[model samples]
Target: MIPEDILFEYNAKIKAFDKDEKIFSENEIARNYYQVLKGAVKMSNFNDDGKEFIQGIFYKEQSFGEPPLFINVPYPANAITLSDSEILILPKERLLDLLTKHHDIHLKITENLAKRLYYKAIIASEISGQEPMHRILRFFDYLKNDVHELTSNSSFKIPYTRQQIADVLGLRVETVIRSIKNLEKKGEVKIISRKVYR
Candidate 1:
């Protein structure tokens, strides 16, 4: 929640991770806060059968894996680099100390965590439904609302690939591709080449 400069001033270390690199595995003890400086990261967990269940995909300037650091528990999911990315690592104790001094930073962290909880509630219902198309559309709407300027019917581009969408939505990649095509035909969204806009 603190600015980049403040993090660098307080027990921060810069690390570069390659795509597909495991930043931390499931059940690992969370001792640090991570802020992505560039590229992307995905947090996920695998089922007993090895099927991946994506928690979320984070892009530049986004932070991940905070709950365990606060609660003194292990990480519930794995954090992996989705692209070659630089991360600023802040130790848990140092971060907690910093938070006590910065009221605005503490408030920002609370606000962001609340937003994530709200998103999770929305997706919980989306995935439990039988309609893959609606689930996909709802997720698209969520993404647009999250980081873009939205008007009544303004269009925005989706940042993730079809496979990424499927993993997050608990659908097959083929299902995502097919459902997107259908959405395009229905004039609900438009896809040009591989870029998806809704």
Candidate 2:
């Protein structure tokens, strides 16, 4: 569990947003970092053609926006709630103060950043291979590692839509749908009432 002192020290507060609401816009100053208390948030960027490509999906209990906070720059991607969500917001000044006072928290932040970098590297490598099925599998593997209870027999509740999944995986929506169908046909996965069970 996260420490209450940390929350207090950072002057954090729980914030709520409705579905399809923008948490932060691209090029907006990174004023605060947010941790999802419930639901999902997607980080995305618009291409020259004005098509949005998802950088990632952050689920409940996961953190986002810290990288830009330390860099003193606008957010590289826009953050939007996938559903109604509760988030804990830690403002920049308070976070810096906490880092100055708590070595352990600083270490934890560094560790989290390192892990994200590692996952990004793996994703980049898979993308270069241009195999949509492999990309989807790799994404599933990452999510399974990050969130507990996601396994062969576990119900993997995907918080994102098919188009969102395709954007995140850098695959065509048709290909993503086909891959999901293949997995279902092989009995490797099942979609029951829109929830995926593996």
Candidate 3:
């Protein structure tokens, strides 16, 4: 993510979005690069059956929807604010100009894009063939590792609701709830105070 001072130097603008606001829809032409300055954003989509699939959830300092900027393609998923948030936006042309001048930022963008791609690949693999229990554990383990907070059999929290977790895993909320409880009973995880820990 670009630092605040760098954004200032670029004259990048910040905009506020209310909770549940749609920042952009699937297939929208990508015109700007965005980073969350506060709150959260989720990139998601609904299939023909109206089943929601969460591509990813992004928090402060995280950038989303930038692949479109680089590829000159429309967004593959919709971005919506998970809460009232401030977002930094740099126009595509300005971002390209800045990248041309700042090799470090360009590398950072590459790293960010790589991370997203890796995550999507992992999720796709998990969803396609894994059992519910394996899928649940692997998914939470992935989240924990991403935060660099993994510990041997120690507990950690996933910053998402059961429904959100289900959406991301392409499972029903009830299935997620049942999976978590089963995992807990099997000593693989614990659901304390209605929050998941593993």
Candidate 4:
């Protein structure tokens, strides 16, 4: 993520959004770079039956929807605020200019995008045929090591809800709940006061 001061220098504007507000829709043209300043945003797509499939969840300092900006294509998913949030927005042209003048920032952005691509690839494989427990553990491990950058085997709390996990892994809510409980019984995870820990 670009530093706030650097973003401001690049003509970025900070905008606020209410919870559940749509920042952009599927197929919308990507005209700006968006980075979270506070709260969370989720990128998702819904099927014809109204079942939502979560592409990803982004938190503070994380950027979303940049692949389309780089390729001059429409966004593949919708971005919605998970809570009342502030986001820094920079026009595509200005962002490109900034990147050109800042090679380090450009490299960081590329690295961030590469991590996201890797996560998507791993999740795609997990969802195809893996058991529910395997999928859940893999997802949690990704969050612990990659997203949160924690290395210890000590407890790591999960930030996502069961429904969100279900959406991301293409499983039923009941399945996620049951799988989590089974994991807890097997010592793969810990649940205390209804919050999952890994």
Clashing pairs in 3: none
Worst 10 residues of 1 by lDDT: 146-155
The local distance difference test score of model 3 is 0.88
The local distance difference test score of model 2 is 0.79
On lDDT, the candidate that comes out on top is: 4
Per residue, candidate 2 scores C-alpha lDDT tens digits across 67-116 of: 88988999989999988999888888887887888889788778777777
RMSD of 3: 1.7
Candidate 4 C-alpha lDDT tens digits along 1-198: 899999999789999999999999999999999999999999999999999999999999999999999999999999999999999999999999999999999999999888888999999999998999999999999999888889867689998999999999999999999999999999999999999999
Give the poorly placed runs of model 3, Cα more than 4 Å off: 147-155
Error of 1 at 124 (Å): 1.2
lDDT of 2 at 35: 85
Q: Write the per-residue lDDT of candidate 3 for residues 32-149, one digit (tens) a residue.
A: 9899999999999999999999998989888899988888999999999999999999888888888898999889888777766877888899999998889989888877875444
Error of 4 at 149 (Å): 1.2
| Whole-structure CA lDDT of model 4 | 0.95
The lDDT values for all models are: 0.88, 0.79, 0.88, 0.95
Q: Which model, 2 or 4, shows the larger TM-score? A: 4
